[model samples]
Target: MHDPKKLEEGFGDLANEQQLVKEQDHTRNFDGDEKEDSRIGTNQPMEQNQDEQSRQQQTTAVTSKPKNKRIATLDAFRGLTVVLMILVDDAGLAYPRIDHSPWNGCTLADFVMPFFLFIVGVAIALALKRIPKVDAAVRKIILRTLKLFFWGLVLQGGYSHAPSNLSYGVDMKFIRWCGILQRIALVYMIVALIETFTTKLRPTTISPGFFSIFPAYKWQWLGGFISFLIYMVTIFTLYVPDWSFVEHHSDGSKRYTVKCGMRGHFGPACNAVGYVDRQVWGVNHLYSQPVWSRLKACTYSSPATGPLREDAPTWCRAPFEPEGLLSSISAILSGTIGIHYGHILIHFKGHTERLKHWVSMGLGLIILAIILHLTDAIPINKQLYSFSYVCFTAGAAGIVFSGFYILIDIWGLRKPFLFLEWIGMNAMLVFVMAAQGIFAAFINGWYYEDPDNNLVNWILQHVFIDVWKSERVGTLLYVIFAEIVFWAVVSGILHKLRIYWKL
Candidate 1:
């Protein structure tokens, strides 16, 4: 509905076009003893050559739009990432079939989050493109970014406690540590600052008398490269036998607590860091989401005759907390990689009109992902958010974005995945609702069972999940479908109400 490009151009035109340019150097160095100036009498044959050279430069100066063009493709790219996230996340009931986001190994599921983050970077870059860094605007940007970060942290930490309002006397120990919202908020703050001073979406080339630059200048793949390198170095260093922190442990022994509890089976492990993560690795360790120990015992086995070594009952703040600051570095890098891929589409601003370009970007990212996977330098683990993880995931996200653009923008087909479009348009709202337990609470009270009864089982029985014989692939899809429908109806209602929950 908004012609953002026109608005950008209108804003850019406020300053004199002459002031926008510099007295640019046309060549490296040229000596004019008037020999470089005229030379007509000395070499009559050179006249045509000089004219041709002038014409060539003029041609270079006269910029043209890329062969194909579409901005709607960006919309599709944005929508596609949101759709896949819902698909993978809601499908958790179907373990092994769709349970891809555990730590260590990566799958098709991990890409969507990074891709979404990357898109955020791209969009922010675009939004800040034309604005000059006036002191007021700079302050506004900083404050706004800080606000987003604080709010994100709030969202992530919300459900851990029941009280709606937080008071001054609330215990710090009661507050849950970092989470999805907190990470998003922190990363956005970091990214916004980076983009603000760095000039995120602007390009480098100057088409004499024209205002344009090479599209690749937009921050995307390049940023991924840098973030990946930094993360890889950290991971490699973390595992080093004589790393800086190796000496921090009490004993000379490498034996570390793989799982931690005062009386539980805590013992030496290969790495102290791993020991910490393993202990805190339970779902219940996460705020509000109760640590679901004895799951196997409750459903299929004896009711706790003994504790299994790998999956045992333990406090979540175990020595092995995976979401530690060190590990989160990897996750943040994953987000950065996604941002880079988003830039790939962004840089093709002029060329998007052409169908082939969009297709190429989509396919190219897929190929790149494969290459990164084979190398294994960029592992796809969601929990660890390894470098390879970011690479492959970002690439996959890019391909999805491209395909959506081709169908929706290139072919002008808008209705096929209106489901995705609706969800995409109001993604943040959905993310908050879904992650903050609003959806889960509503379902538990209505579609699902009450608090006293079995949690997962009741949801499986009464919800749209009933179509399936079990909580496998079919069940997951059913939930995803219902959620999408829920979101779609909500989006429509918002449209009718003319209310946008703008952050």
Candidate 2:
């Protein structure tokens, strides 16, 4: 007799538990059809560099693993992240304010990467159980890592402004060399390799019926803690060196720039990193408006220094440099924290209600992150991808996962979020499309421009202003609506046509 009411108890034993989980493993069903359609390198090798490599190799693509069979919730979450990515990414360039902050400050759009990375970790945990052979897995891992790294370079290439000549524009060679997907690729390979070698020691066979591999999830938790601590240590220890900065106005005293802290002027969160990144990462180098405070630093000056004493320039302040690789440490911990949540999800097995479990933990994490932030123990900086960011973001992701799981899985209310699911299904394609020169260069050339002249601005100024219905939130809402419509249509079309994409 088994307790049908209790989910985990349905399994008779470890093998039975594996069988139960297998039944729910949606990834298996996707293997033959969608996998091939995407033309992902499942067990083949590919060239290391897109630009340099002339030789072609075959290998498997490490596409996303459906967390479980028929796990619509996971798919939905992935789609949700993609949708957010597009909106934040594709929105009419609002200049410095709308774009990502460089170092410490976060905006409405900053959570997007953390969400995507967390999903990557979540899917990896589930997929590790299903790899057919170790050799094939290794091949897939290398190819995928290279592909991601290459893509990251492409993003950096398009955006980097550090040129050898530095005359009228930027030089592509020394542009920091990495981006978001590149980091994800590195972490994914590392985690997969770790799983491969360690799990091999046990040699537990995962028959189609079921399989069981007991991993101490404590590792997951510890990894998050370690990453957070190490990141804080690094941040506090290392001071960013500055070689370029324009001087202040007539006042031989310093000028203040906004930062991510409570007193916005003291830190460079709002200005320095954000301005520099926006300047460097755009199609135009320093002239790209908004974060165009070229030569701004990321630190607040001392009152005594007057910002522009004979010793230093008057306009000194901290710089904003979000998307700085250093901040990625916070982003990495987001994945690590997410891994712990996955571990806990498996560990709890029963007792806690799913959504409540996720929600409560999320709230707790938010509080903790805020507290840590106040202590300056772990600053919450999106630019630095600080641990505070990890705590808040991971908590948010966990709650989201819980809510969707309960609604779609437990409550039996699974409807296709086909709109999001479509992009989710072919995430690689969607992102590649986003970065490719052919699309963005051509399309955005026509649509976006004069960030001051965006439709959101137009609507709010013309219609809302005339009607005396002025609300800044409405501007944000209008933008959000536009984003939703864009993703819904695009993703829906892809989903309906069964057109999946890969790299």
Candidate 3:
């Protein structure tokens, strides 16, 4: 124990081990740092003196990966939908394009609802990915569905007109059961349930490969496809009392009549969708002022057919909502497709991979829809929520979503689009406010009476209407300006307060 030479040797060995451990730790830390850097952005050469070319390359790589983790694209896409919705809804004899197509074809206004529904699907998918408990997910779905339905009824339901007179409350006879919010709520419930059950039963592991791309949960596809098939089967096979145009000369009046089965019954009277809606909710409970009402005085060609005669029964004055009962079944498919897209967004790590998938699928859907429509297998009718219509609109929605994703999420060009994000973040709030006439009432009350008369009318009449020299364009711009300023301020305040109105 007292051997000096042997003790010195032992101490030397211990010192050597300590040094080795330090070196290993240093190496591990360096490797970890490198990995983290690469995860955020590509690693660049750290030379003592780097050339300009290499420096430029590094800059490019750094900028390529956006600094923010938020998906600006979704917000922007939703915001765009909301903006267009307000614009179209507020349109005052301004543009036909802002209005829905008479019956069969689509207008710019028609895309708003389907696009919103698709976005809802995508949102649900993203949300459910982290929620492991099926009961919790179902509870969320049920509560949201009920809330949306109740609010829809309260906002748009036909209540007593004499509320100011203190006569009574809601008129049960005129209550609208199927409305925009009601339909959205129903669709959301069905889709959420499908996703919940599928996610619980068919949990899947991600396959490694670019071309191996598919839904993480295959049951989602199965559910969506089955819904789509159901819609097609029902449309082709369902039997109802036939509708036909009846011209009465004695009373100098005309009305649609029910006759037999709907074979070539594509008009307002003979279509199965309108027939079912009338039977279910009754005509008085449906939308009374559809875009078709304005087009009643004019004769036009049937969108499905080439040309129609003046007396071709193209006039349908009945209150038929495009978002009717039967068409909503196919709407589920649209939302399901959106869910698939949301899965893609969550699963794929690389930006290129996500963009590639979106573009390919979107273009493919559009082409297929066009083919089906041209072949007359399924006409693109928004009123019926035809298969081709669903495909076409959903495809357009995908492409739009991808474009926003690229601009806001990938390129980091976010500042300029913050307004849209603001509005989008509070979508339900804005929608409810607008639907409840809060915004309209506020804007209408903002007027200060002037010497010449009403200031609001004066500005609208003299400034926009007179300057633009086109009532259609001027009135549209005025409403648009008002909406943007008013909603933007409200949304901005909410954003500053960090208030997000969640379902």
Report lDDT per candidate.
0.45, 0.50, 0.66
Using all chains and alpha carbons, the TM-scores for the candidates as numbered come to: 0.62, 0.61, 0.75
Question: Which 10-residue window of candidate 2 scores lowest in summed lDDT?
Answer: 6-15
* Model 3 TM-score, 2 decimals: 0.75
lDDT of 2 at 105: 50
Task: Report the lDDT tens digits of candidate 3 across residue range 410-438.
Answer: 88888888778777777777776653445
Q: Report the candidate with higher lDDT, 1 versus 3.
A: 3
Query: What is the Å distance of residue 96 in model 1 from its true position?
Result: 3.6
In model 3, what are the clashing residue pairs, if there are any? none
Model 3 clash tally, residue pairs: 0
